[model samples]
Target chain A: MRAACHAPIRGDFTGLRGLEWDKMLHCPAQAARAIPTISAATSMSQTRHVFFISDGTGITAETLGHSLLAQFPDTRFRNHRLPFIDSTDKARDCVQRIKDAAIESGIRPIVFNTLVDPSAVAALREADALFLDLFEKFIEPLENELGQRSTHAAGRFHGIADSQDYKKRIEAINFTLAHDDGVSHADLAEADVILVGVSRSGKTPTSLYLAMQFGIKAANYPLIPEDFERNRLPVELTRYRGKLFGLTIGPDRLSQIRQERRPNSRYASLENCLHEIESAQRMMKREGIKWLDSTAKSIEEISTIILQEVRLDPQSY
Target chain B: MRAACHAPIRGDFTGLRGLEWDKMLHCPAQAARAIPTISAATSMSQTRHVFFISDGTGITAETLGHSLLAQFPDTRFRNHRLPFIDSTDKARDCVQRIKDAAIESGIRPIVFNTLVDPSAVAALREADALFLDLFEKFIEPLENELGQRSTHAAGRFHGIADSQDYKKRIEAINFTLAHDDGVSHADLAEADVILVGVSRSGKTPTSLYLAMQFGIKAANYPLIPEDFERNRLPVELTRYRGKLFGLTIGPDRLSQIRQERRPNSRYASLENCLHEIESAQRMMKREGIKWLDSTAKSIEEISTIILQEVRLDPQSY
Candidate 1:
């Protein structure tokens, strides 16, 4: 059976609701042959039903398909997508077709409409077929899953605003970094972007993403206790204020991340993590360092926000 | 008009195609109005026709949606998702309904599909609409573009797979390298993850991606001439070989990345860059280190592959 799941609400199946593929039957087709398969009662050899529905896009559908196939590894996922829908009529029509197809095919597969009209959702629920809500279930929860952020930094923004020249920024950051490998403080003046974060606020990933993806040079430094002891944004940052940006995460999140590494170090202690976050944020505000609250955001989101915020357009590469 | 151009497959919007309310386009009612703003001529109103599309759930799509909305600075995105469709038939049907509705609404907006589906792609193209093929245009290119790969050094297999844990590996490498302000190399062992890359291979952003998204402690280091000259990984890496990973880029890409920085540095010279890459690759092979080619691959793809290769399942988060 070509059973499928989709997310119309959120791209990448992040918002897909219910039916954790992990827990789904791995070999639905094979399972059917087994005495206890979900559809074993039906004696239809041609009982192949493909159901596609999403809260958003088909990403989760694809992912879910993979898991379902894992249960039934022999299944093939035929790609499909429906741009966000805005009306209930289409959704209603879709539900009716799905319900009918399920009965006819004897597969009883579920369909996901990522952005079906709420009325459409009502229609599906009323159809007596299992329907997964990609929005309320999956997407929302993933977004709220707070993870520790990194401190990797990208090169300062490069690219001539007119030319979109990011190449130079990447090279400069690379050269500056290479030439001054052990000289972190020496090249502060050459940086297009420098990251400052309390412990690990996701500086490194953003920096690497910028360089690798956008061809921007990015540098990052942790806000160690010593920096706070001195009560400054790294004395070197004073020389290049425009290029500096700060990243901060919620104290609770920070502590959890630390605990993962050190387990029980004083620094990894929740209280310590909270103290560090509070201190770093205050320092950033006082130092007039433009910063981002990265606690709730994904790396991609954080990178975009920082890049847009810095507005550092470099040219020359 | 909402003008979006896909680089790979030429975009010819002869007319409106369809809209899928995705995760970002949370309000279907709002998305109904938003899709047309891009195509709206003089008819201006408060309605936003922004939409987000995903296969299963709004998970990843929601992130992109939020970022896009944030990009407009002043503009708003009314996001929605089209639910459930996994085959060409459903895609076509959904697209047809969307095209009809878009015309009535006067919003001819671009559709972004994260999941790559040739059939749906063909249908979307046939509809004379703007489509964003995330994998085709955005993702696959990263793999070919990376041109270089990273090496597994410090944690376990070498250092990447060791039972010593992540932080210690990072700190060991860091401690080996000298830093000012009492930032002891001894503390380098604390890094949850470490990224090593040739200049311009995009270490910064990848590090940040992990840190920000996964809250993994990360550190990044550059692969320099002396290390290459000796055909060995950095000395600091010896202590934590399992935790170490390398990133490399193509010579041409390196040149482009470098020229942007120093414009004329000998290191950025194509000849030098090529030599550096060859040496790095040879050394990695000799060291029996595992690595990923960074050329042509975007940070997201690279991160995905490496995280998976490293057995760090992103799904856990």
Candidate 2:
């Protein structure tokens, strides 16, 4: 007899709902027999099925859920996202799925939900799992504090509530895209903030994040060797001194990032990265442009800092 | 006498900190005299100050806080974000800022925080505000449920904890960028999902969202008028039927989106939008490819559906 395989089968729950626990746990007999070492590869960590259910996109529940779960690094969570659970029928389906996950894992599943509809919330609460209703816990307190009744809207949080705001965000994304890596100088004046950095110091992704998340038109320009030789800011950027923000990276990290893009090239050399970053920093200092080190920072962190430092007028963009 | 200006002064706290409340509330004398009608534009809505504080990016705090605050549509919130508050000194500064806002608004501020460090949390709790520490409420319950102590780590949620995962996300962003709007066919085989849609049907933003948030390499191709005329799926996408996901929008919404790009043109006409969407949907139906209506759905909703329907193997990507 082949040894039992402990790794959970990862896929959609629809096909696995009716399967027996033994069948779900075991690999195919032929494959298990062929790979006798499979049983030895079993993970020692505890496994728990986790679900993020919401009336809208479920992004909030998932984001907060992930943050909470990150604290418990010892356990492995088999994650599932059930988004757009607007109707009672969908809520019922979600409950059933949660129950199935509990049965399959032989552990009560942990669910984080942001359903606002009372009926839908009540329906999902019937599942035999640790249901953490995110909205239910705070809505009443908020209502009392605000001295008004909440709309209790299902999809309002992520919905396009304000058409003007939505349009501005879309425009920002387009502006960011058009100005990416100094591709176009036609509308440098329109940029809410312009990022200048050595290539791969993390300007592109940061710019995109600023636009996508905050509706800020961010443009980025690369500080190449020619700029360093000239020891001056780009002519296109000189006029927009107030909008300019610089990004610098550690030489080692810059080289490591570039190494993946262009292996065994002069551009990926540590010496080159060092010289470029130093030159960029010196120029930024001389020009009185604010800058940040993006060595270990996430794009969100970098964007947040830029927003704080740049202090762009929200109404202007 | 000039009626008091009601709009909250929006700018950096450093400049506003020591200013008298009257000076902060009222517009400049010259401007107020010139624009005498400003008093007529005073908003009657209740105003409150809101703050999101965290040891990391504070994005999770802001996201959840926004969701909660959206319930109260009647109140205007003067929002502030104090991110990367990992030290007691920073937390003290944050508390001071909150107090300043409270004084300026003549109402206690509402603070949402996700600080993990005990010293920082304690320091921030000193503010004369309704402090809602997000982590404090959830961490204990989670700890009890998991039967393990949390690591109590600051900045772990958004930091580069797993370098491999971070690298994959960066690669995904690059891949999505290169493959955006069918700009490159060099790595079509590597895309985790290919989105097919008519122009301005929300393919690019959705693709970028999938890449940025979920670390999925998503490529998008617009089903142009030529594709509708040919009445067929694009030849390049035919081989990857399983990876294809289509996005269809209401003709009116599509036309409006296109109008923003090219105003008063045939491309932005409702008739053209309808024909392109119908043909694309028909082709997708014939090919048995899954798709969604992007008319009112946010990019997060669309991407979640695609991830669910496509069910790509995590290991394969």
Candidate 3:
């Protein structure tokens, strides 16, 4: 059912009409509504070009496309994207490419800016595309609507026992404890589940996966030498011994995922990553906390196993 | 991420095995590799008390709970759903309660065996909680592969071209041709955009939304005049069309969606659900057509809107 996004927003009016846009000065919302009609009234309507552009992998533009289609169900789409490059030149190039296509095909296109580069945004403005700048308008409303978020997970351990889910729930609490999300936590007792892993041990995806797929409410904290040197779980973790779960990965694969995210960074090197994975494994063993090696396993497998093994299942929707 | 499923099917223990299993039988595939081990393990693992059943409104177990997470990415979850109800008495009660909970929860609970009855399935077997049975096994598999499917549908419609997307691609050729998987023809072409409106239009979710979403190669065949003369859209439409979208509603709501479904169904009268919805809406808007009502909008909304605007993003993983 997945399809490319190609629908135009029908935003600007390329039509030459003195009275067509008189409705806009009356109310911006109404003006926005009239845009589609005015454009439909003119030959220029079919001359526009549309594209879904982004500065960050274009994920946001894809989302905006979904939302726009929801608004205009009948409109046909002609989608295009300029990947990785975030220059005004790229943006203008995108506009021209789409324009060329529209001229040939007789269909206008809309440019959806989902986090396009700041400068590129200006380029879109100069282009003849009907651009709908989403990032600028979405942030505050999204923030206010969602409020302070705890976790963005959705699972209810149905066939799985409550106890099994709860185990994962506690482990997630600990994982969350170890990770930082601009939140403050003074002690392990305050944690629901704590995650212990050496640096780059697939912690973030595993933790997020746990919180999301299983609603384990996970937080991950990287294990470093100081804690191992002391031969102890973090001081905070001692108070919530039952709530901790550990994630480990094979030395080689651990290095790969990290390297991709941050190439050549000291932390992402195979040697460094392997050192941490090994040390974290030893630390978990010494501490008697059960852990799993995530090297070969998919993140889903790793997180779900942790969720089940640790038995932490947060029930909130 | 999707590769794990094709992991050469090695027969050994999987990550699912908890710490307590005997080392010799640790590997699930390997342990089960031999028939004796399977028999022994089967005998040893006693049955449990609960059964969670669902007389499906229509969805597969895996796709329902797990896939539901895609809609709200931020909501974390710990979900489990039992499979087909096995033949057992104790299972029925368990199934009933869970079914009740599901009804209350208001999400599109996944289902299997559209033709089977939960109670009847229980009767087929004599067990404690047979009502909820078919689903028990899949939970592990799903958990075992969470993140692989869970990037919030990360790249569902990435990089797809508009012309290639189903709606635009399949627009003109919706001939009443029989195809596998129960889709029909007029249902196809007439469905280039088909809105199955029930009174008050039910927002014509089932049919219209699907067109909007995936471009499922859509074809919407309205329930017009044959039901009206017999009055439905023309009989030829039934014989040949693209997608058939359906919109239904509560008795009172029927008037509303029906007004939109066509704004006219003699069957839309209050207290006449059987005649209006079941009869006109059912009895095959045309033979072998799928539908949804405004009353069933939430579910249809899930099916329709999702199917309506599929962003043909290139596969992310």
Candidate 4:
């Protein structure tokens, strides 16, 4: 069964503009009053129920499910995440919860499942919903191509299978913490990547992400005004020229970000931000260090670009 | 265009056991020699090439693709991630890269694409690979269910859409950093969850994961010998009893973890680990705080369980 019925248009008609803009500016109350006739005409469902169930952490299921749901911008989805459903009893309970959501929504709920255990999957298959068995759909094709059967193991993806890899990730996190903000030169040579940026230009979070997610020992150094006056990179960083990557933010965004930390301070002024960014860019160019603008991108985007631009293999790290 | 032909078995015969065992112990050299006759007989292909292409960071495509590939454990896949493929020019360049991979590997490459732009998707369709368009497959069904045409936007999943949400994530990161290891008690009241655990028991990484992934303000405190000696919870944590969550690790695992940090020290001894764990468990039970074992679970699993146990809505944070 599928939830093909139309739902009530609860929000703004501005969405109908079909242009990409800031969604946070969307005022629901004003939208409701702006298109009363359309809202009155469409009234079949309230909210669609979406469930992401997995044998492990359900991160993959939730991520893929969310990406699919984002395609429909006007629809409201009430999401339910059921992770670590490895046992048949837990799967049975999951089926009950999904059935309840289906009944509550007056339509079949959409389920994105990544359960690998046969018994648990069999139990969850009893649920009356649009069951999108993510693992089952792709495993057969992969098995055929590989000329082998899958392990059908539960919790393998996110599980700590390799002790060495797990230890590396933990060590990387500790290394990053100890080396944060140029606090330690003890292990500068051990770092896989070193980030340089003006204060609050998104160095710490990016370094943490590289360490936590990819097991890359990332060290970050703040490019202060002293370096700008000297017209040179930090003396400590000169030895690791190949590992250095720069982050630059737009002056306006940098100023706004700084204002939150220090209200009405000279450091938070737009002129200071502009000067700092220009100097950082010039130094990076002189040092032949590749850099990117962090003003409009998320940390994930910035990290991925850094990895590609620096040609750093995360797996090797 | 699918590469359905069998590939040469390069790894060990022990994988034929089909039993859940330590994959890290599977020595490829031994496996290659053990199955020499079978390896000699099969000579169709060497390795398969896979690409993850998207308009944004391509994280979702890479994640889902990795999950699918994990099902085929015996096969070797060469992965190429191409992010920010937003224009037709970039998509055409991406097709050339895939074609080059196909030529190099002597097999048709597998492409997992999440490009939303119609022109870019069309340009990528010219590639000679098993094109698995993730967004296209699900968007049409979603559009039918929602009874509206999709905006066909790109980079919506990981893009910083809401400035408020972005700020909350940054603030959460900062809050978790400041509160790490009980360094600060200034904003304990603002925390959504506070984790208590012995040192090296996986508290810091889990706290950071909670902050980074969900934007939930998490503070973690280390339970030291003083608290165990006193046989009570910390006085500062007594007021916010409802937000307390405990993490315990297996004594053996804890000892090994500590030994890496401080070798041959009394703190890393097995006896000390056992006593600390027992005392922490007793204190947690006495205080009626919920807790979990963090020895075998990843930070993602532990964080998800903590959120569920505490009934903390990450979205609300």
Which residue runs of candidate 4 sit more than 4 Å off their true CA positions?
A1-45, A315-317, B1-45, B315-317
DockQ for each numbered candidate? 0.03, 0.26, 0.02, 0.18
lDDT of the candidates, in the order given: 0.46, 0.74, 0.40, 0.74
True contacts kept of each: 0.00, 0.35, 0.00, 0.33
Every model: Cα RMSD to truth: 18.8, 8.7, 25.0, 12.7
Instruction: Tell me which of candidates 1 and 3 scores higher on DockQ.
Output: 1
Best by DockQ: 2
Which regions in candidate 3 have their CA more than 4 angstroms from the true location? A1-183, A313-317, B1-317
For model 4, how big is the CA root-mean-square deviation? 12.7
* Pick by TM-score: 1 or 3, better one: 1
Q: Residue-wise lDDT of candidate 4 within A90-188, one digit each (tens)?
A: 788777766656665687878888899998889988998877777876677667766789988777645565678878998999999899998988879
Clashes of each: 189, 0, 157, 1
Error of 3 at B249 (Å): 29
CAPRI quality of model 3: incorrect
Q: What tens-digit string does per-residue lDDT give for candidate 1 at A115-170?
A: 42455456556564444443433333222321212111111111122223333433
Which TM-score values does chain B get in all models? 0.48, 0.84, 0.31, 0.85
> Which number leads on lDDT?
2
For every model shown, what is its TM-score relative to the native structure?
0.39, 0.86, 0.34, 0.84
Give the winner by DockQ: 2 or 3: 2
Task: Report the lDDT of model 3 for residue A83.
Answer: 34
